[model samples]
Target: MRDKLTTIGFDADDTLWHNERFFQLTQAYFAELLADHADHDHLMERLLAAEKRNIQHYGYGIKGFTLSMIETAIEVTEDRVPARVIRQLVEAGQEMLAHPIELLPHAREAIEAVAETHKVLLITKGDLIDQERKLAQSGLGELFDGVEIVSEKTAATYAEIFDQYGDGPDASMMIGNSMRSDVVAPIEAGCWGVHVPHGLVWEVEQAEVPTSNPRFRELKDLGDLSALIDQIS
Candidate 1:
């Protein structure tokens, strides 16, 4: 273990719990509904492209993604599109809105393990109400020493968080799923980062390749996290 360690920041959403799986299912449903008008793969491509183009307008979350699907379906099929598909989209949207919250496997165990020797902080971004609700449902709300719900995770955000919690970069580490927002941001801010990759990562959260660095490491899953943290320290 390191002689002087202070804090570790963790990402929420896919990192701490199951996320994006619902969006994948919703996309599958959307494809089925649009099968008569266009190929499933083509429809998905168009929808994804539209979402990317309108990211600044719609932001992230199920509501925006569903809206993009609906808008794209209308565009591809024209106004003659069947009511059944539209209705299905509406119902699917509602189901996604109501989807239950759940924790990722080994999330709490990882948090508890790290918290034993470091100040564990949660660094997540989303609609404040929605994020807070998820955290409440996670059943490990009390585990974090600090909680930051930002609009975006950037180098500046990581720097601010580290500055507020610890003296310098060496005293802190970031453990999360997204290399772009979680790992890269903190690393650029001068803190070390450990990536715990989830099976499903959102496209928007992807990062460019890293050449190599001793302060950055990737783990297969949360199960390998504690051991890596020990090794790093």
Candidate 2:
């Protein structure tokens, strides 16, 4: 088993560092900005709708989210959204882009421990520049054998990445907070999936847990990841 598992894939955002909370905070402010036009619930719903509609055109990350906020505001205000509000939205995204990286509990330790014996790769999806900025700021960049800033997480994506980095998807494991991308898709591609819950999650990333699958695992935090790998090996 030790020799069989040669590669480990880690998700960047919420799994290894503080990410979704910043988005949540910005969203709260977004709700406040358009408080006059719509209630909190309705505004969030509309913003989510805008995000869903805009994802294909804009892709994921702060810029896409900011644009969606602007679009939602325009819709709710019947195209009367103030220019000041749009300016603020853009500024909010700018702050998120420049924000310092904060590592999640045990993130670095887990990476260091795992990387000693297994190849470690960072697999994430977002705006290329913003993703690169965060990776640079994270200070963990030097540890990874490789980095893959993908456009999306799918079975084929995982298969290709694992094959490029190590033996193949069947000989690799993916650890992340999203059940859809981190667990289901990787497992579908014949890799092991480890889910480390981050509490705060984006709606689009949500998916049902694959409890029936033998390769699926749920960790309380990254603190125990090394022990789990040891057990598996």
Candidate 3:
């Protein structure tokens, strides 16, 4: 299987480096910032709703998330959210954009090992600027043969990407944390999907594990990827 694969796509955010954890931390701060306006639980509900609603409009990443936070605050406070709170929200987003890139354990090692014999690509959907910034800071940019910052991850999108890269679905593999984007979509596109569990996943990215799919694989971490490929090969 490994020998048959000519290209491997890796999801950038939580798969290669820390991402959702920062969002989780920022959410905690947001909850505290609006504690006086609404209860934590209610505020969280509103935030989730806002994100889902704004996803199509703003797409994914920090800018959209920051906008959703502001929208949620306004709604939760009945349009009475303070200017200070808004400023704080903007600052939180800026901080996230400037956050250091911390690669997950064995991420570089795994990528390097795989790249030695495969064409590795970074496939991530997010605000273009922020994603590029993280990739630059991650210091692993050179490891990938190509980088794609897409608007969304879907079966059609995966198929298009594979075609553009000159690799058929049967010769492509996608590895990531999101079952919806990384596993199901790619598998649906006829590519192999490998799920590497991450501790913190955004609610919108969540989906049930596809254990029934023959092309779907769940690994404990990126560290196991090489072995899995070898075994399958």
Candidate 4:
């Protein structure tokens, strides 16, 4: 086993701070707006499907989210829907941009504890400006040694970053909430991966929960993370 851990990569959005909750709240409002046209469950299905299909075309962030909402409204709304309904959707998107940012449970203390022994790096994916604003407001930005805000996370992404930083699989780890994006991608890239479940996961990012991977260990929250790392290290 590797005795020394040199670099640790972390996913920022849902991992270090609250994120999907805002999206959920926005979606709930959307369901109410279109209640006359379709039921809540069907609206969610259309919205989730649209999001997945538009990942490349719309990219990620509030812009994509807003556009997805608009598309869903168009698809599900009754014939000749009022202009005010469209305006309402647009306004909701703007509201999302102004949504207050909150840190996740135990984020600060866990990052602080891990930073003492590892060269901590923040690897997150989203709209550049929005993410920067969130990190700046988060107050935990100063706790990390490096912050990488990317448009997406993949095996190639991890490999390039690890190679450029002069760290390999054994001495580095990727910590985040999304199983497919965070856990699977980094581990496939040859780095240790730790899975931390979040309160809300967007339907676009949801996948089958894997129960069989020695390299992947599940933890309750950031508070328990430091001790887990200490044991493995």
Best by TM-score, which number? Answer: 2
Comparison by lDDT, 2 against 3, better one = 2
Better TM-score candidate (3, 4): 3
- Give per-model TM-scores: 0.89, 0.98, 0.97, 0.93
Ranking by TM-score: 2, 3, 4, 1
Position 48, candidate 4: lDDT: 86
For residues 77-190, write the lDDT of model 2, one tens digit per residue.
999999999999999989988899999999999999999999999999999999999999989999999999998999999999998889998789999999998999999999
Q: On a 0 to 100 scale, what is the lDDT of residue 1 in model 2? A: 40
Report the C-alpha lDDT of model 4 over 60-147, residue by residue, as the tens digit: 8888988888888888864456789889988988887877778888888888888898888889998888888888888988988888
lDDT of 1 at 195: 84
TM-score of predicted model 3?
0.97
Q: Which runs in model 4 stand beyond 4 Å of their true positions?
A: 1-3
Greater lDDT among 1 and 3 belongs to 3
Q: Write the per-residue lDDT of candidate 1 for residues 1-233, one digit (tens) a residue.
A: 43365788888888988878888888888888888899987887889898887667766666677778888989899877777778888889778767678888888999999999888899888767777878888888999988998877878888898788766566788888888888888888778888888878877789874548667888877888788777766
Q: Give the TM-score of candidate 4.
A: 0.93
lDDT of 3: 0.91
Q: Over all chains combined, what TM-score does candidate 2 have? A: 0.98
Residue 28 of model 1 has an lDDT of 88
Better of 1 and 4 by TM-score: 4
Name the better of 2 and 4 by lDDT. 2
Lowest-scoring 10 consecutive residues by lDDT in candidate 4?
Answer: 202-211
RMSD in angstroms between candidate 3 and the native structure over all alpha carbons: 1.5
